[model samples]
Target: MDTADRLIESTRALLWERGYVGTSPKAILERAGAGQGSMYHHFSGKRDLALAAVRRTAQEMRESAEERLSGPGTALERVAAYLLREREVLKGCPVGGLTQDPDLMADPELRAPVDETFAWLRERIAALLSEARQDGALGPVLDPADTAAAVVAVLQGGYVLARAADSAEPFHRAVGGVLDLLGARVTD
Candidate 1:
């Protein structure tokens, strides 16, 4: 790859592993096999490079969701499709995992993509929940926004739990529990 592409790819991988603050320029240069001159030629520094990486991650995530969310299905079917999609659970959310990094979250420019990505995902899920509610698949008083946020949190948290526990069982259980909790019931 070209220097610019190499730099972006290197940053994306490193950011996923070490986070923004934890990843140093020295590590990036070595990882990319690019020299100081080569990296600086493409990016101002770590922040500039990280900003690009975060934006790239956000775009990727948005596109992936839109693919499933917009697919043919009932609200439950669509939601389940998105949730049940296989993932490398141990790797976690490339963007959401960065949210836990203090240094990354502290930088407004760096954090914007991370925040926006999650916000967009929450809104998308909320739209699906709204549809479910309208079709009487949900409680009439259900709040789509809160429910959506909870769903997002569960998936994100599931990744964390799975990663920490070093097993995908937690992730599967978490998603299944969420579906069961949100699924319609006949009880009063």
Candidate 2:
């Protein structure tokens, strides 16, 4: 990879591991094995580098979700596919998980990608729920926004709970619980 590409990828991993507050320019440069001049030559600063990483990760996630949502299926089927798709659950959703970082949230420009990513995901889930409502799949009484929040919440909260316990079981149960609420049969 080129210098800029190397910087961005290093920033992404550092941000993922150390978060915005915990990460430092030195950490990134050290991780990338790029000198100070090489990094400053590419990015305006740490924020610039982190923004690129965030945007790239967000785009990747959106593309992955879109593929699953667009695949041939009923609305419920698509929703299920999107939810139960295998993930590195312990690592958390790259975009969603970043939203909780204080330093990241403090920088409006840097935070934009995280906010936009979740906003798009919620909208997508709500739209799918709307379709499910229209198709008589989900109950009419179910509120689309509430349902969407519940779906995203399970994933986010599961990550938090799992991280707290340092185990994947909470994430599993949370996702399973949401699926159960959606009236799908839960697998063993």
Candidate 3:
């Protein structure tokens, strides 16, 4: 990749892996295989590069979710697909993990993409649930807003649990539990 691309990608990985507080300009340059001149040429500094990285990560996360959430299927099926999709569970979520970084959260520019990503996800999931109810695929008793939040909570919590245990089983179980709950509400 080009210098700018490499720098952005390196920042994304570093931010995900090390968080903003832990990531340094020197480390980013080392990881990106670029020099200080290249990084400064492309970005004003670490924060600027991190913002670009965050934006790219947010876009990627949205596209990944859209692939399953917008695919042809019942709403629950689509959600299950997203939840069950292959992931590097041990590494945690690139976007969700950023929320844990106090330094990142302290910066409005750095946090905007993370905040926007979740907002978009929740809205999209709620809309999917609403559509499913309208189509008689989901039970009318389900609250789209509450259920949407629950779904996201389970996924993020699952990642935490999995990381703590050093296993992907917790993540799978969480997804399975959610699917079971939703399965009970799926209309014929």
**TM-score for all predictions?**
0.91, 0.91, 0.95
Report the lDDT of model 3 for residue 50. 93
* Residues 1-188 of candidate 1: C-alpha lDDT, one tens digit per residue: 88888888889999888877678888888888889998888888889998988899899989988888989988877988899987889988877878888988899988999889999999999999888888877786678899899999999999989999999999999999988988753123
lDDT of 1: 0.87
Ranking by lDDT: 3, 1, 2
Question: Highest TM-score, which number?
Answer: 3
User: What would the per-residue lDDT of candidate 2 be over residues 25-115, giving only the tens digit for each residue?
Assistant: 9999988889999988988899889999999999999999998888889887888898888888778788877887888889899888888
Model 1 — TM-score against the truth? 0.91
Best by lDDT: 3
Quantify all predictions' global Cα lDDT against the true fold: 0.87, 0.86, 0.92
lDDT of 1 at 90: 90
lDDT of 3 by residue, 72-186 (tens): 7777779888988999999899899999999999999899999999989988999988988898888999899889999999999999999999999999999899889888887
